[model samples]
Target: MTATTPPAVSMLAPARPRRPRAARVLLAAACAAVFLWPVVMVAVGAFRTSLPGTPGGWTVTKLVDTYLSPVTYQVLAQTVFFAVSVTVVSTLLALFFAWVVARTDTPLRRLVTPMMGLVLAMPPLFFAISWGMLGNQRVGLLNTVYQWLTGAGHGFFNVESWFGLILVSSLKAASFSYFLLLGPFLTMDRSLEEASLTAGAGRARTFFRVQLPLLTPAISGAAFLTMLAFLEAFDIPEIIGIPAGIRVLPTQIYSHINATYGGQYAEASSLAMCLMLIILALVAVRARLLGGREFTTVSGKSYRLERWKLGRARWLGTGGILGYGLLALVLPLAQLYLGSLQSLFGRYDGFSLDNYAAVLDDAEITGAIRDTALLAVLGGLVTVVVCTGLAAVLRTRGGLAERLVTISVWMPMALPGIVLGLGIMWSFLSVPGLNQLYATIWILLVGLFIGAVPVGMRAAEGALAQIPRDLEEAARIGGASRVRAFAGVVVPLIVPSLLSGWLLVAIMISGNLAIPVLLASPTSQTVSVEVLKLYQSGEISQAAAVFCVISTAMAAVGVVVGVVRAVLSRRTLLRGTG
Candidate 1:
């Protein structure tokens, strides 16, 4: 009988790569220049101590001034409070909901994950604008209904308060945390829980003593990452906190650049550096906390957990899921729809298509829409290509330089949007010939591209990691070029995941408010920036209309892409079948 090669043996066979060393070096250099250099430029820009367009010598004066200011201390303390509270509240909420879905016999459990995904996909800018309308104290839907029900003269609720800021932020944060924790819950082994129950422990005691400890690592990791996200949050804070006189690091940096008359480029750079340092320290602590402590539930082999029979509590679980969907997704979107049909923001008696028509007819809104579309497509594709190329290069190439380049490509994970935007702006301005690039649409493109690198890189790397090098080796041995080998053998294996990731990246770029706020000029403004301008310009009803248009478009694209991805993911080739 003819002997066939064992799968493991074939996978471990030595292989020669056809890719040229010079080409690899050049590609690595290009990636570093695009994805890595701008980060270093952030620190370099902080010490420039000059106006953005004007040339000047480097100095530490601005950095020293920002570091010594008492107001900086106040902002720091408040930011910590806000970040910590949001983290705790969001984590607890996600843990509870995730448990209801993953551990218990929650009715309609499958619906929970998808709904949360939708919530996570909905941009914070959309919520900030929606809630700004829903809780306006004067004519907000909530307050309007409240006064009618209670027979009060004035509405009591205001979204522009500490309570509102945290509420809005926590809702967004919880959706993300739920997804992060869901995988852990799903993968957990049931032996410990089974043992605890057999020993006559109550469910509560078992959860607290046995299961919760197993989940502590995931919970802690989620908390730190969530804290970092909100630390540089701008939309909710800018819309809600500023009216309450709340100053977080992100908003403070924005004020220095855009809110001030002439703009303080030097001060903005200094503040960006400070926030950068703070996030770096947090990231370091998080790394230390998680190092060598990735708690795996499966001991030796994987086992399944039977969903607890919750008896009558299953309906209660379903109710909780419905409640989250109502508040997080349904209510705000409902308010936005209702508000969009009105000619005036708060008036409810009469409705019109005038706002929609006007928005569609306006040259500026149309321009912004066109610009947003161009950027989302161009930026998303560029990010995916560059990141995909980097992932492939890392898999085959080995050197200290390549590893350093790899780190640089992934370093944007710790960066907040406005900080990175400021860095890019300063980086552009610091060079003489490139100063003109700052005022054009191209700068926003670069900012958006880099803003997406960390996520895109991770997605690409994860996809590439799953694919065996053996397939590519076989292709190379058949006389295929390295590029041809990858294109022929590896791309098909990971295309669905890559396409799914690319779609999400495109949506994110479409609705991105923070980066565009810093980098966009009047002519280059995107749909998201237009929404803010409309709202802030006292054109609330029109702003709602704009959001409705964009959200509807994005949602349709998301649904279609999701379906295509699902179909593509079903290919048997992905599973080593036909």
Candidate 2:
């Protein structure tokens, strides 16, 4: 018995290997610096009495002065008002459409999902431009049509007003909420509704008590996101608000930066800081609201989804869905295409191919097209790679390093693109050797990368969550190095999601104007910036033409990606079965 003192160590026992803590700490610190450097630069600028390029002394006078201005409060109030209005309208419309398509047996239900993708692919900037062409009071297609049908002396529509701004913004915002809410709507437990019905609740009452309550988290989350979107929105406010004498925080910041006699950098920085604080507050509130409870509906248990039958009202539901498509998608695109064919200011003298011809012939337009394509591809690749790495590390690790990395990746979500652009500009210009990147395409790439990485991280995290850790563990246990195990076991499983995330980021980058406006140099201009210049310079049809080309390209890409995804999925299913 005394000789049995030492037992043989089992080779199968789990190993508590010490990971490289120093490497993780360094990586997290680097990522945090990348994410927060611009923000810190912006804060420095906001507090400085002078601009970065000039001699500056640190002070809070700018911040105090901005707060003391009455116009600041007015703009803040209007921003809140616009954001709240858009959120409410978008959320209600999204709920209705999500319910109609996901819960009810609506006609063309198969088309609803793809159509929503198409709607989302069309950028909000394009929507603003299209609506501007459709409702410009004087030469707008809608106004022209209204005048023709009713024989009115004056046009009946004006997109430059608050009503028009809210309507267009709400329509765009609704598409996002629709996509976000659709998943939850489809996956929610039908047993809850059934139980309510059995307990003497009518259909409508059951929906309100059982179905809607279960969807509260989804609804609230979508609303908060939509609100932030509207708050940070630059295209809509810049395009529609300026002409209507409407000023929101984003547009106001734009005005400050683009003011005559070389813009006020300090003031712009102060405004950006204020906007950042507001967004941070909103984000904090959202986290607080969602932190306390679990909202998952799907589980290991098998459950059947029971689609509601609307009887004859199903046709009405179908009609409602089609109507939304008509308004949100078909109508604006049609107006854009038709308007692009018309002369400048959408003159109805006769349609011509001149706008398209000009777009093709213009060197700047061609250059912008090429530049946009490059930016989309390169920026998207970089974002995906960085985000995937960060996500993988965070998922596998724990403690302070992991937490730091998580916080760093998420910091961009609270910073608007405009603020990001401004901060990046300041950051590059402030440094000694780095100042060379200030006006180059690299700056724009950096800005877009920061803006898009957060989304990619979220997408990657969702994909990684579906994969089991045991696969990697098994490979490790089989004498495989950690790198080899990750490459062989993890990469293949997550490729589809990574590809999807990359495509999404590319599409978004191609359409983004906010970041480009503040960062792009003359030679580095993108299509969105070109479109804005054309519109601002009153080249209406040409702007429409450029927008039409870009939108068509994006739509075609969406279609191709969808088809490819379908084919790959089918092949995968076949392989599994075989």
- Give the TM-score (vs. native) of candidate 1: 0.93
Which stretches in model 2 have alpha-carbon errors above 4 Å? 1-10, 13-17, 294-302, 555-578
RMSD of each: 3.4, 2.7
lDDT of 1 by residue, 156-198 (tens): 8888888998988988899999988998888888887888999
TM-scores, in order shown? Answer: 0.93, 0.93
What count of clashes does model 1 give?
Answer: 0
Q: For model 1, what is the C-alpha lDDT against the true structure?
A: 0.85
After TM-score superposition, the amount by which residue 70's alpha carbon in candidate 1 deviates from its true location, in angstroms, is 1.3
lDDT measured at residue 446 in model 2 versus the true structure, 0 to 100:
88
Clashes of each: 0, 0
Stretches > 4 Å off in candidate 1: 1-25, 259-261, 300-302, 562-578
Local accuracy of candidate 2 as per-residue lDDT tens digits, 1-578: 46655654455735746678889889988988889888998888887766666677887777888989999999999999999999999999889889888788888877777777778778878899988888889878778888899999889878899999999999888889999999998898777777789999999999887777778889998998898888889999999988999999988988988988788788889889889889888878888877888766664555668899989989987887788788788889888888788876757778899999999999999999999999998999899888877887887768898898888888888788898889988888888888878778888888899899888898888888988998888898887877788888787767777778889999889989999999988888999999999999998789889987877787688688778777766765675479
State the number of backbone clashes in model 2. Answer: 0
Evaluate residue 564 in candidate 1 and report its C-alpha lDDT on the 0 to 100 scale.
87
